[model samples]
Target chain A: MEASIRTGEKETGRKKVLISALLFMGLGHLLHLKQYLKGLFYAACEVLLLVFLPKIITGIGNLRTLGEAQPHLPIRERANSMFMLIDGIILLAVIFIFIIIYIISVRSALAAYDQTSSAGAKKTKQGLNKAFPILGLAPGVGLVVFFVIVPLIFSASVAFTNYSSPGHIPPNNTVDWVGFDNFVTLFGGDATWAGALGRVALWTVVWAALATATCYFGGMLMAVVLKESNLRIAPLFRMVFILPYAVPSVISMLVWQNLLNGTFGTLNRTLRTLGLISSPIPWLGDPWLAKFMVVLINLWAGFPYFMLLTLGSMTAIAQDIYEAALIDGANKFQVFRKVTFPIVLYQTAPLIIMSFTHNINNFGAIFFLTGGGPMVKDSTLTSAGGTDILVTWIYKLTVNLLKYNYASVLAVMIFVVLAPLAIINLRRTRSFREGEL
Target chain B: MQPKTTKVNIYTIIVLLFLTVSSLLVLYPLVYVVSAAFSPGNSIASLNIIPFGDGTTFKHFDHLFKNTNYLIWFRNTFVIAAATSICTVFIASLSAYVFSRFRFTLKKPMMMAMLILQIFPSFVGMVAIYVLLLRIGGLDTLWGLVLVYLAGNTPYNTWMVKSYLDTIPRSLDEAAIIDGASHFTTYLRIILPVAKPILIFLAIASFTAPWMDFIFPKLVLRSAHKQTLALGLFSFVTDKKNEFTNFAAGSLLVALPFILFFLASQKLLIESLGFSTVKE
Candidate 1:
């Protein structure tokens, strides 16, 4: 009788495992169907892979043959085709895994549906209880896993490889694992890496410090001036100042570019008309002046944000603080210096840091205004202007020069430079993470 | 005591007057551009604050329309911007809801990763994006540009929408669930109504970005027909025989929609700004 009981217990345990797996599989299938209705491409891919894997492989092989015979194909073209084949296969594999997971989930759900317990509707309850966590997290995790985590891994890995060139090299030329060679070359003073690094560091500091300070002070001033109880036409003034922020930076930069033209630019014309100069100011020509102009233009673009931030922060400040300051025999300047500035600064410090980081990589303003022009003399770097920030310089190197390794190296460097600042900003601005939910 | 109060008020007035005057310096370029847009001749070379030569003609606008691909550009800009804003808001809102309401294992790390990724500056990945798009047959298409914009904006918009969602209480969700309503129903009925202010703000913000974006359009949409407003304007102004007046006219035209939108939504926009700050 004891032997019989042991055999029976083992049989029930096997049944339970089978039942749970089957239920999970059924639920996953159902979810995939729902995802199909939602137009998820990956879901379709999942369905295709489950329905027919051999056909897909055959199709890819045919495409590869076609790719080989294409006329005037670059060496990298062949490599790209091969990588595409690999990527397609990987995608198919992922789809298969997804389908398998889906099937398991459905089976579990079905098992729960079938089981009987002292609790009425025990099977459905158990299935649902098992499925809830997976149902909640599967899609979200899938997306994060696929897009964010995968791309990050790929990019980080690329940093270690000599995958910069477009020409195809045999056996995974897409990512030849050079193993720290890229990093070493970057830090070893080959390819002007050190000079570029120093320049990036110097400009980052200067740009951040100046941009943040100017915008902060300027914005506070505007907010204060606009907030005066006696000031009429405050809305008009606010609108005018806020216009820079409202208008797109590209438009602003383009307009400014024209205005700064040496020959017929309104700015030069105005300066010339005022007898301030005999010739047009080479605003885009001179390195220092160009940098200065870019900063000034950025200031114009940036101040409105600070103005808005300061205005909002100011309104939040209690009116009692100012009144108390006044009662304590503090003058207007004193009240503002002690009460207003400190509160605004403390509130906006994180935002200021963010703005500073943004300026470090503000390619749009620089790219449009000068295209990082007045190209540095005698530099092998094509399309690099003296004013080129690391971001634009990377673009110049990779796109214009096709120096993928250098660009990747530079990109990794940029991240390294800004990572500390970002961490600090993220820590300080709890709202930033909280808002991400 | 009366004299002292009067003196303080006078000082305030004086300071206010000074600021008002200096503010004109900021307004001068915009005013100049507007004046230039209207001026009939190539009088932009002059520093004349007033409309100096052949004042007030619609010829520049006429020239801008007739000579350039202004209409195509306008259409492309509208299509791209509208499509990007809609897609971005839709995707961002859904993801944000998930992020906001769902307590999953990967949530914190995912959010942190997005923050870190954003810090790297998108331009660093431009080449990679370009190559990726080219491989996928997305290069030179408006949809390609839109996708790029969508991917680029997801992190920020998700953060914004999530923050907006945070202002709402979880009790609403609990009540909905107790009523046998699903998560979707709670999101649609409870969260969305409260999120209108942020939605409008984000819509306006998202709309403005693509309309003004030049670089990606320039890089990806190399065909003249696919040019956006910024690219179109850049090429127009820089093309041989600089059409200063026409450029100004095109700029003014481009600025109109945004300015009008801002005016219409000024109250809500300001409120949203305040909301973001307070929440932060």
Candidate 2:
């Protein structure tokens, strides 16, 4: 009798699983498991999906073909592939959300059948209680999907299309897929485009490196000086040092722009009054000088942050370690080199890399200070300037030049380069360790 | 900690001298901006060698209030920043609480997704965001800017809050649940109070982001009535316009309060940054 009952239970569980999997998301729970509330919720999802099915299909189809050309119609009345592409991506996001719900429904059915837990009001309460996390996460995840993910997908899609201005703008024209063409043009196909890409990419890397290093070392120097000094008014100086960082960067950059303006800026005016130079210097008007000034100005705006960070990390270093180093016959400089520097670097290595990435996209520092101006001799062809890094160049391309395809290609390259660094960063953070929390 | 010395050492003298020179380098522009704001002219050209700029006047402030859309821009930016702050805090904290306290199958993948999202250059999607907002009637609207900021804020902030929340003892949560508290009630009454520091940091960070940001507002908002402080003040110094004094006055007004806030909250901000970024 026991064997027979076990067999019957096994067959019933299989039946419920099959029903939930094959027929509908909630049929097993509704018909056999007595989980009426949970089943109804799942069933409602299915109903919603069915209602939107035709729209979803067409949206995805439009995404694939972009859109059919309607050349006979007026420009204002013609089909817009860009709109269709965006709408299709949004629809795809919705479908993914539905699929996630469907999986959850199936899993819940399996669990309920396995446990043979017949439902009541109390069981429904437990079910809702178990779903608290999902409910909490739903709104944020939903917004990210639509706003972040959809936009991201749409932009990435642009890399594979011919979506520039003049001839290909929507209504006047329709975009079509041209796989690898933008990338090829950037890499080697066109001499000007290829050269622009090489120069911008090289400058971007060099700029990130120099920016990260200068701020890091400059801040470290100030932090060490402050720690070692016994100045009477050090607190006052510390506050002063932080002023550059505290003031809004936009304000600071604009101020610097005015101060360094070759013609009428206060810096040049003050210098001339003091008899420093016969003529005004083009601090930002000359390409090489502009690049140098960019790094220097970025140092001014950026170092205080690292200074504060270093100070915080230094304070956390143990007094015993310093005492031990001193006891080992090491002088102050030796102690710093051997113990303090290593400790601080270990603590802040991740942040240093993070800052590197930040500087790579430091659009404001370049854009506001120079407006990516004093254009290089050949940079006008690509609409980028001497000081334009990859990001600012991308900005110029999309916003100023209407070169969507090329901008998207650069954006993709940024992703390809940065994703691995982010993963490495994730691995470094102990809090991000899998199953740790 | 060093032995008290009556004599000032050469090392200390050098350090102080270096600091003074650097501080002046940092201070000159600020002083110049302030002097320009009050100077009796509209250009930086007339200013003297001293940053005091001949004399002081309130004309720029007067002009800022009466002749321009400064107040409207202020109101618009204030609204967008406040909305973004409140929504980011609530939504990020809610999701963080789940990631902290709950164990679901998708939890790891979701966490990983958040990190990967940061790898993408956010503004690359500017075209899509523009179109999306246009379709939803968010263009030229403050709320549309808020949505974009809130979306951008969610991923990294969720991780930061989650890291902070992890430091809060799980036993307290278990005790609440044992006392028959629902998950949300525990989150509201127990977790939020303890997580106040990180949340404050997040709030301040998000609040200040819109003030410094010049790019997105320029893209999303077109109407003169809807411009932000950054965009409006930027207009004063652009190639087409040169109201440098007006720009200076406006910027000083914005920067003064921010500087004060940063000074007051320095410790809280630094500590919170350390908490979120550093592992034990």
Candidate 3:
């Protein structure tokens, strides 16, 4: 009786597998026919080979030798060609693997559908069913891998290569694989390298620190005022304060630029009219003042966001905490210090860190406001201003100087510097997942 | 008791007075710009509160219209922003729905990967993007700028939508399934309707992202005709010295719709944010 019951179950499983296999096979055939009409006959041939004829092709073609044969190619050229060849091979491998998986799936489906009496066929069909969703994730995963991940890998690789000029182009442009030559140059007590990097780093750290703190406090003040119970025009204040955020940064920067214009700006003119100063301040021309002005403008652009965030977080706190404090004879300031400050800090620590990182790499504000301005003479640092941050410096290197390889190196360095701060922020925000999921 | 009540009233009055004064300081610059946008012969250098100094006129607006490619920039911005908002909300919500509803094996890893990617400042890969886009013939195109913005905004939008979806009960999905509704149909008929507030919030947020973003547009849209409002306004002011008034007027034109949108949707915005940050 037990054997009969088991045989019945096996028959049912076999039937299910057989149906799925036939369906997949039919779909594959349709796709092949469609491809043929689209003139992808070679690709279709490859697909069929992957699906039905598994052993015809043994090894994938090497892409490197396809380049024009030159025995005396430059090291940089050869290295570049080799990298491309490896990349092409990897791409081919991916296509090959995909076709193989599709073929195996369709074939398993077909076999399971055809062999209704085989219990093993039923097991294979169940396994494929379990693996199907992973197949579905292929497109998104493929996009990120090819576009973001692969490029990142290449950029990181370029940091170790001496591939800067026409000397690095393939054939003639063979890159000598100099492991960490660029990094060593950057860190090896070379005055030029050390000086440029040191200056940019100093400015970035100072600017980020000041921007983050000022914005945080400014935003907190706005939030506290808006949250006041007796504040009658709170909504208007919110709108006014938040207007800076609503406007694009470029526009805000331009408007401020006009306001700070040495000859015609409202700010300078107003100061003069008020008899505060006899002359216009060279807001963008002077190095120290330029840095200060940029930070102040960033403060304007950045504070509103933090204000909105703090306001949102503030409303989330339980009213009873404040109420309980009031009932215990605590004044408004005491209740705020005990309840409001800690709650906002704890809840918004992650956001504050994010704000810091953002300010650190803030390219747009710097680019628009000053263009890292008042270019210094006798500086080997191409396109760097007295106030140039690392990012703008990298932009200057690549765009202005056409030093793609070195710029790529700097880009990697920037990522290395910023990624740790990002990780810490991520961990803090991860707790919010509990609130979400 | 009466005397105490009077004292409390005075305290409230003083606080209100202080707030009113602070509000004036905050609002003055914006109001000054708006009035200047309408005021003719308005020495932009003047900090005059009253419009009586030079009298009000629409000449700056007219100047803005004639002197710049204002209409083209406005059209491009509208098209890009509208399309980006639609595309972002649709793709993000679809992905968010999958993450929120499904019990897939790779879901956790996928979410974690997205989160990690979000933390990396996108400028880190700016050079790579520029090279890639150049190769693909996407440079100097609004479409290229759109793609860049879309890629940058997706992870955040996805998380936002997913958080919204989490607030919805699983029982609703179960009920739909029991009634023989497919997952797609269940999402369309049941979940989307209920998730309207979030959908609108995401739409507004997405729209504002491309609308307010200047960096990618500055990088990608090189041609004047293809320039979005932000880039167009920047070039209009900086490329010429005398168009500063026109720049102010153009800024007003650009800021108006967003300000209106925010004002109109304040309640929904607050609700969506409140729901998103609400503790489980």
Per-residue lDDT of A1-437 in model 2, one digit per residue for the tens? 99789779778766767676558978878887787888888888899889988988888888899887889998888889999999988888888788888887777777667666333223344777778999999888988888899988888999999999876888788999999999999999999899988988988898899999999999989888888886768878888988998999998998899889999988898889899899999999898899899999999999999888888888778899999888889988999999989988888888988898899889899998998877886776898788889889989999888989999999888887788888887787666565462
Residue A310, model 1: lDDT of 83
lDDT winner = 2
lDDT of 2 by residue, B221-258 (tens): 99999999999999999988678889999999999998
Cα error, residue B18 of model 2, in Å, equals 0.7
Order of models, best DockQ first: 2, 1, 3
For each candidate, what is the lDDT? 0.67, 0.86, 0.67
Find the 10 residues in a row with the least total lDDT in model 1 chain B: B43-52
DockQ of 2: 0.70
lDDT preference between candidates 1 and 3, better one: 1
Instruction: Give the backbone clash total of model 3.
Output: 16
lDDT of 3 by residue, A1-437 (tens): 99899788766655554454344433432342221221233345455755743332322232323244355755444433444533554455466555655565555444434453444324332333334344334544444554455456556665666656546644455554567677777665466766676677788888888999999998888778678644556787677777777677777776676677677767677778789999788888788888888888887778777777777788888889888999999997898899999988877776677778888778778877887776665255556687788777777776677555676677777777777875675565533445432
Better of 1 and 3 by DockQ: 1
Query: Which DockQ values do the candidates obtain, in the order shown?
Result: 0.44, 0.70, 0.36
- Interface RMSDs of the predictions, in order, are 3.6, 1.7, 3.9
Per-prediction count of colliding residue pairs? 22, 0, 16
lDDT of 1 by residue, A1-437 (tens): 99788668656654654554344333222342222222233345445665776866665563334134333556545445334433443354465556655554445433433343223343232333323444544544454344343344445545665655555333224444467887787675465765655665577668667877887788878888778544557777778777887777776787788778777777787777689898778998897898898888877877887888888888889999989999999987798889988987787776777787887777787888888776665245445667777777776776676666666777777777789987885776556544643
Sort the candidates on TM-score, descending order. 2, 1, 3
